[model samples]
Target: MARQGRKPKGRPVSGWVILDKPKGMGSTEAVAKIKWLYFAQKAGHAGTLDPLASGMLPIALGDATKTVPYVMDGRKVYRFTVRWGAETTTDDTEGPVTRASDERPAREAVEALLADYTGEIEQVPPQFSAIKIEGERAYDLARAGETVEIASRLVQVHRLDIVDVPDGETTVFEAECGKGTYVRSIARDMGRDLGCFGHIVDLRRIAVGAFDEEDLVTLDELEDAAQEGREPLDEAAIAAGAKARVTDFRPLDDYILDPATALCDLYEVTLSDDQAGRVRSGNPVLLRGRDAPAFCDEAFATGQGRLVAIGSIEEGSFHPKRVFGGRH
Candidate 1:
């Protein structure tokens, strides 16, 4: 069924991929690679991880992209290493040395500084960050040798624990924090508090929201699977060089989480077939008793064991906020 000489486009893939991104690869690049491998129609990521850092980067394909906002607002956990004695222009190893110090804080001194960062506190983001300054990225401005004065904003650090002090040169630690918390800022601030300039040398994200390390799939594993002919195309697609119909790529089910899992933390409301249809049509449905869970604001409606729509509650009624068509 070829129409003229138009090139073949892949099929629609709808799911979430919790990628264990390798170090030195940017988050955007990881998303692009996964999108290409899957030949997905649409894709996006929940958060941005620096090229110098690695670990859990959730890629949303097709319908799953709708739930990205909720995942981005979720808490995150990171384990990072801070190298003392010098501060870098980017607050990490990627940037050049901007300041140096012979001073090194004692283990006790570092421990005391953790408390200062915990809870809600005002902290300035690193100058070499993606934050916008007058519509231009702060990093771009800083890179151009322009003075970038980023204002301090309040961020929450739920837990800050020192995992190990590998000699007197570096400190390994873990941080559990809410949205917008930057690991590099923590390292930068800690250095200033200790009077010894410091910068993050290693960083890895372990968890984001409900997705954790256990859910991650390495890019190499996926590539290896493809090489093994795990993704078999249908006869017609193969003839057309389409490979587009290879939706049933073997082993992908193991790596790809159900699109519904993206909204697992939210409340669930299973609706009748008629109600589900109405919700899909962007109509509001009145929920009663068990269907209406107390203190539930955000929820997803399911019908026939498939995700129908994501909605919010108001006046004991569930309103279809983001309607999802087709299986997620």
Candidate 2:
């Protein structure tokens, strides 16, 4: 028998990739392309963008996948076009025409409808969505010609701006909302309020969490850059795309941001060198001088020390979740 090679050791390549997803491609396809490009051992996207939408899709690689859910829970902003006169089964252009109306609401009427969605409201997700139905995906159920009735959930629309009326019928609007707020659902509700039926003809997510469209690199651009012997995709390039959302940790001299920057938004607790070492060893460290709130899991250093770990405080001590550095 041939000699077997030894398994590789140490950590694998890990980071985040912010892709400017193109229209007509599913989120899974984008993730696969990136995985192939980097030859990553593991990869996952923070959120899913519809085939009709194009914009920032944050992909987490290696250990960064553990932090994806925390990033995905952040706010998102989108610019979408609502076409008056018809509604689709999926609420976007992907589905068949389920309803139609000849009444075209005036531009002002559409603007008025925006107010109704400005605050918290219940939203019924479209049938052709990724939502699970009795352990199966809702979209799968819908495609199989099965009746799927998804429950309505409350979502917040922080800001809804009517950017332009762009004629008498269509409305171009920008929305900043919490996670799970579907722009297509907004379009459908707006139509109902305006005494017309509408559906999203074009949808583009401009921002997700702190990542923005400006930081996005298109698939074509990334491939072109790779072919020209330019910079290859790596953890650093991937981290750059997620930089906008990461909080600034450098006090003044240090300028480079790492993947840990993503945790900067959380309230920080400084630890001494001894305390940090213990924390990295997975011990609970008691914090002082701060009344840390729940969900704040980050910790900084007191001197020229490195961040040791992220921990949750309970019973007056911090229990480490992730460890980075030790006494130095």
Candidate 3:
């Protein structure tokens, strides 16, 4: 039998698919569906999104998967609603109630407490979380009826604001945070401090790194595209066209973002034939040209707008760390 998942099969399609994940779909499930729909040889998601949450899950295909870490390290923004009366075992609606309260906090009180949650704060993740404890998943242990001591770690909450309070039962909040910040932890802790136990009733991730809500494509859209025969062009074809300077060819599906799209956050250095050749060969070269980006610790090089490598600039020289072989 062929080694499973060792060699990916199908088209070598490479790009980012910004999925508007539905509330019931897990991140892995979404990635699997995308892989099937696109017939991609390789696929992976930038970050994990809980089944209870929805929106903007970035899935990288083929060579795009090489840039997954960059997207994973980027900031995340979410809008979530917290039920004001109880805290759950999982910190969200899927779990049973662990604590309850009758006192609902006022809007003014919630607003006043927002500042305290902003900036860097220590947070303890919920028991039903992915954190590892002695090489075992915390969630796995919790599910097995084991109690584990989870440590609190600092997470950056760039901004946290109350979006609305539709009723005394729930309060909506929009939070912009760095990687590792948990929206569920925010709701759980806030409730305890406010003396009104709470849990995440609804959650949606609106943005991650270079992607945002506007870039999302629903599963229904993917199904429609598949049915209509709309799909990303083959990577081999794209490579051949690039060599022939054929920039006119466009993918049948316009929704597939370029692999370079993930590097939009980095400084860009357009390379000449010689410079690009050196970068592609895993060699460093002195960067030149009026369009060369300013000195930066990290940047990406492109030839004719196609990604060559992600590198660093030091003493006007670009050193390739991760080469893309000039793939489109």
Candidate 4:
């Protein structure tokens, strides 16, 4: 695809990179490699995958980094294979085999257990994780051979479909879950619940937020493209990837949706230009736009049908809390 827009010159570059990460490389390694290729001073990945796992990993550069947290709030999907009868310290193949069992549940039995994992469930994160415990990273504590008790957090497993159940001691599963759901923990928990210890042997992320594996460009492909003077940031190339899905996709001249478009479906209150300017200036504005008996003391303002600013009414004025679409 032909490169769109002018080639940037020392200006801070901002865009998303959906990397089809290769195995044996950690998520941070992939980010570092891409950052070197782009010469981006700032970059971050929305979610992380184990070195043994590979697939859609969204790498946000420059200003795109600001949107990383928002993007990460979306659901994720993974296709992974679990080896039954073995439990690992890290819950994946990378960990040492801490325990083993001879029991192998039938395929029917495994499918029955999947149903119990669907919907909202409580899950404890793995010990080798970034979660902090008493101000120190859990992984740090784990590496120091310290036992840390991590609290269980509630997460939703939107869907858990059994992809394949081979006669051997391995079972393959495809699951869609909300943010913060740990697949490794699920694998370990499944083995325990099924009367057999288990550990993830192979795992591949199919989707992160709206980006899918099919849309990712492998590192080799990207290198070849770069060598051929193909810039993935080109509009055509980006449009073909996951960045296009959640992006505005529309021309700026066209009416811009409120930056809060994702939250538009929820309760909202409109404001006039004068009121919007006041709210933008840190004044508290009332939610008089809606006549259905104002349900909230908090009021938000919109300009040109897009959420321009949000604020809470205090003593008859709305003080702006967040302003979107403005040059930050």
Candidate 5:
């Protein structure tokens, strides 16, 4: 008898997919769906979104996964609705009602409250949150009928605007904030300040750093494309003039983005081929050009607009801190 080998796993798919997550689907679940749809070998998400919230969920596959941290540190914009007169344990409608008030702040009063929230402010996250307390999730503790204490931290809110007064019980708001700012905490604090308890009735993330709502792709679109066999995986190999191999997955080149896109916030530095080689070998390369970006803490090094490495500037030299593999 001949020896048998192990079956192959997933394909080496790489890129980013901005998903328009629907309500009731957790971020992890959305990632799993996308990963399976693409049959990718490696995948991850930039940020965590609760099941009750829906919006842009940036899924990073393959090499793009290395840049997930940059996307996570970027700014975020959220549109949410606050239901006045009642508060919930989870800070959203999913949890049981914890308190109620007859008073509802008027539109003028809500507008006045906006200024206080803008800029840096201290906020304590909700008890029903993923924040860890003694190695266990705070939500887990709360679910087990245990008290959880979350310390307050400073978070920045760049902009907060009241979009509309939906009804006597609800107020819609759009907020642009830095990383770590929680929309639920904003609603909870605003209600307390206005002498009314409140909870988030709805929440949607519209933007994350450079990625806006416009770039979102729905799950149905991906599934339908998979079913129709729009572009087979072997097409990718054929296009590259390589040997064709059999596979049952759609081509993801159109959906995936170059890893360089994630480093848009950093300045650019072009290096010679020799420098690029040095960078790829995990060594720092000298940078010199008439248009060199002013010395900064970090910059993206490239060879003819193709990413070579992400490095730092120290003492008139560019240090290749994290070099990328393969051509862009």
Candidate 6:
């Protein structure tokens, strides 16, 4: 019997592409599009963005996929609009209106209810959701006309603010919340409390973890930059000095973020070349730096400004869990 390392076909491009997904595009479709554009061997997205929602979708290619969970669990910011007087089955404009109301909430009423939604709260997800139920997707059952009782979950909403009362029928809101917080649920529940049924007319995710809306690369921008297809990358090129790392990836356009960009929230340990070499080889190393933590549940290590590995630190020693190959 023989064992060998797995080698990826195609260019082993790796990095985070913070896509500003346009409305009506699905998260999976966006990920696939990026993968095709970069010709990456592996790719995945951190969070799910609905087909109708638009904004920051952090897509990880190759080694960056390892950091997906950390970014997905991080805080998110959304700017959404809710239309009063009708609640839909899906809690958004795409679904049929299930409840209608002649009543509309006042600006003061909406603002007062903001505090009620803030902090830890119980939220019922929309009927049309990806959540699983008895081995089936909730949305599939919903679309097939089968009614299922969806359980409510505890989610944290750090802050909610009424950005504008655009009209008597619509209100724009901005929310900063922890993972699993649904903007649609907020609209539905707030409407019930205000005595006016509501549904989301527009939803946009402005940020996820370390990525901000300002860091977004639009779909149009990406396609425009790729008029000339990407150049072949040696997998290890990202760590091969600054100039090659910049010019070798693609055109002069700044489309990709560092693979470690999604790891900003993690505890970081800067390592020496020798230690990095050991870490890259799947070995543990003592955290000899003066600022090293005695213990940490999760942390990432970097050497010579290149990502080395992500692991946990126990008793002043860093254990390599998912090690990055080919330098960066």
- Would you estimate the TM-scores of all the predictions? 0.89, 0.79, 0.89, 0.70, 0.88, 0.90
Task: Kindly list the per-residue Cα lDDT of model 3 for residues 69-188, writing each as its tens digit.
Answer: 999999999999999989999999988898998899999988988998999999998898889999999989999999889999999999999888899899999999998898899999
Give the C-alpha miss distance for residue 164 in model 2, angstroms.
1.6
Clashing pairs in 1: none
Query: Tens-digit lDDT track for model 4 on 23-136?
Result: 899999999987766555577898888788878788876655655665588889999999999998888887789989999988888888987899999999999887889899
lDDT of 2 at 297: 40
Query: What does the lDDT read for residue 215 in candidate 6?
Result: 85
Model 5 agreement with the true structure over 208-286: per-residue lDDT tens digits: 8779877888888776666665434476677888742324454444666667777889987778888888888988766
The list of candidate 1 runs beyond 4 A from truth reads 1-8, 230-248, 294-296, 326-328
lDDT agreement with native, every candidate: 0.85, 0.73, 0.86, 0.72, 0.84, 0.87
Q: Which pairs clash in model 5? A: none
> 153 in model 2: Cα distance from truth in Å?
1.4
- The runs of at least 3 residues in candidate 4 whose Cα sits more than 4 Å from the true structure, single-residue gaps closed, are 1-10, 230-328
Q: Candidate 2 lDDT, tens digit per residue, 4-96?
A: 996544224466667889998999999988776554567789899998898888876666676676678888999999999998888988788
**Structure candidate 6, residue pairs in collision:** none
Candidate 2 vs candidate 5: the lDDT winner is: 5
- Kindly indicate the candidate among 2 and 3 with the higher TM-score: 3
Model 5 ranges off by over 4 Å: 1-8, 230-251, 272-274, 326-328
Per the 3 Å backbone cut-off, how many clashing residue pairs does candidate 4 have? 7
Off by over 4 Å in 2: 1-11, 228-257, 269-277, 285-308, 314-318, 324-328
